[model samples]
Target: MPQELEIKLTLEPAPADDAYRWLSSLPETSVGPTKRLANTYFDTPDASLNRLKAALRIRKAGDRYIQTLKTQGEFVAGAHRRLEWEWPLPSAVLDRDLLLATSLVDSVSLDELKPVFETNFERRILMLDDGKAVIECAFDRGEIVSGGQSVPLCEVEFELKSGQEDRLLYWASKLGEQVSFFINLISKAEQGYFLAGVHRPASLSAGAEPVSKLFHGLSRLWLTGELPQEYVEAVAELKAKETKTDWRTEIELFERLMAEPSSAKVSDLGKAQLALLRTGVADE
Candidate 1:
């Protein structure tokens, strides 16, 4: 019943300090000290847990450790909404009983479980609220280690604690005015799986063709409220298909609002994008 509603975006062409400062400078934001977190993700022999769209991990926060289970949920309005369960552990070891308590009870077997990958990062957090919306903004910087290979991890996550999804998008649009970022749908767990040569997210398949690939990239910019020329061309192709009722009409409006982000209201495009978050049409 506990769901995590969060959106992640990568800061591009902007220094880490700049992103930090920008979030700090925002109104009604309370800053917290940065904390280094080390997380180890686990899976079973055949990766049955991954197949179930669930990730199990034990996190080390200073002297404290936590075990968490998260399901890869649907994307609504460009934010990932997933069911999550967390418990404080006495140490860094995974608790078998806790794993059995989650929705993944039937799929989890303690004996076969093994460590897959790890994500170690330093997180700087801030709470942003203006009575209407409360967002836990986390700017994480560090690296994800796997198979003797690691990728630098730096991204900001805006998790909607409570309030309308539009409110979270509004603050993101305002943040985009000063910094350049791309919406990233991939979660840390998914990234590690791909990095570990264990699993590939379904989103990567969107790039199999030219048009879908373009649209996939375009979707990543939904929060920025800035429409690129390339994206306009991509949407044109997507709009060409006639697969679902009202889908065409929706894309038409998206095409118009996406044409000029400056003149058009950000909320309009945001709403349009959210409408298409789950494409109603498939190419003929």
Candidate 2:
């Protein structure tokens, strides 16, 4: 196995919306949905750079956990390797699987179906909303292989595409968190908030106010085929709830704008909104 070589750049949150627009406007690349991934990551409490662990995962209607051990050094040129091992566990939890992976990083190869892997350096981020909320962002460069063939070419991801990206980017900027991408480091659960259970306001309510309400607005636009009062009212309601002028309102407003008819102006707005949405989801 060769170590994966990559770089991560922190994206400034203030320009994240514009950054998203920039990314979308570029020629489309080898990215988007065709494969599925759910990884369990682990780390030590001290937050040292190298003390990280992870469990690469496979889901066959159920779940399979492959333990992987990884160590990071300065980014190097050539084929970098991620060592992996298949482990037997009493019960499979991502954290426990991550521990096992730490020991097996040398055994797994990039070419096998039992496990699919990719190689690319990418960006990750920790986002906050007005100093009150947090989410993780990962943009990966790699491939998914099963049985020695390509399944899906991995692209940069803006995950948790349920909320508005513009808002989160704004929030990250206002919170003074550096928004640039990071060097490629393979620690999945850096904050451990996802496992500890981050709140899911969007998943719960069709009408309930989302702390990040942009996804709902998009859903409405996509489903109705036309923007309605619901879209505008949702923005107002969210704005009032914002109580403070942050990215939250901006996101809702952008999402509303995305729902407009796909005219030339609307197309540009949609493209811009898509960038914010993509960036926001990645941070999650």
Candidate 3:
């Protein structure tokens, strides 16, 4: 069982090209080949798989098609930890027998799985080696399409290949400074479901339980750069809770976020948001 560890961030839409240029100019990184990835995510119309906190996708990178299943995992600050399984397929279709081989054999009805959305993007990977750590920084730019609705998918992922998360966080913060970005907690599959239909159920929070609502609110504010009503309500909920030494950490962080001046830098605010999110994981 290989669990993935990475920090996924969404680049500001307008400067996506600038992000690519900046990545190419990095003196410390070894730029790797670029590949266009077309990934189709599947699940029953009722989103039974999503409810189970898993995602299924068949990716077409060049001529090869790979089936991937990612189980429910953890997310904190800007980092993700998830159990992932991948298998090669003959073409772009799901292999029932192979899927059943996994632990979710009984959780999902194999026959009902259908394509709900697709993510077609170009990925530019850069290898960073600083003697102590090796990281793969991938810049992804594309669109997530489902039915007639589509949303832009512009993200940068810092995946730890041979080092500590401390290194990963350092790189994540560096990228946030160079490019206008926000920590992305929503998976592409979840975003697809959201675009497919609002009536459908979604498990979009990358945050764990308890402070899931706060995570949701903060994620929205970071992605869109606007504090919505939902965020206000989420903060209010946190404020209403008693501040115990242990559980009040999130509440205090939320307060700190609110106390931040309107003149704060974008990158600093982003870092603060991540700090607040990290507390949620600590509690878990």
**RMSD, model 3, all Cα superposed?**
4.9
Tens-digit lDDT track of model 2 for 87-125: 544343433434333444354332221222322233333
Which 10-residue window of candidate 1 scores lowest in summed lDDT?
A: 204-213
The numbered model that scores best in TM-score is: 3
1-284 per-residue lDDT for model 3 (tens digits): 78888887766656567766776677778889899999999988788888887899999999989999997587654577899999999999689888877877888889989998899999988888877789898889899898977888888888889876678777765665666666666677777776877323333443334344555555555444455455555567555655433445435545556555233344544655555544444343
Tens-digit per-residue lDDT, 1-284, candidate 1: 79988877765425456867987887789897789999999998788888888899999988999999999876554567789999999998788887766677776667788899999999989999878989998999898999899988888899999988767667766666566665566678877887887875544243343243334445434433455555665576666655544656557665665655455443344344444543534333
Model 3: residue 151 alpha-carbon error in angstroms: 1.3
Flag regions of model 3 displaced more than 4 Å. Answer: 198-213, 221-271, 274-284
| Colliding residue pairs in candidate 3 | none
When 2 and 3 are scored with TM-score, the better candidate is 3
After the best TM-score superposition of candidate 3, give how far the Cα of residue 257 lies from its true spot, in angstroms: 9.1
Q: How well does each candidate superpose onto the true structure, as a TM-score?
A: 0.75, 0.28, 0.79
Candidate 2 Cα errors over 4 Å, as ranges: 1-137, 141-207, 219-233, 239-284
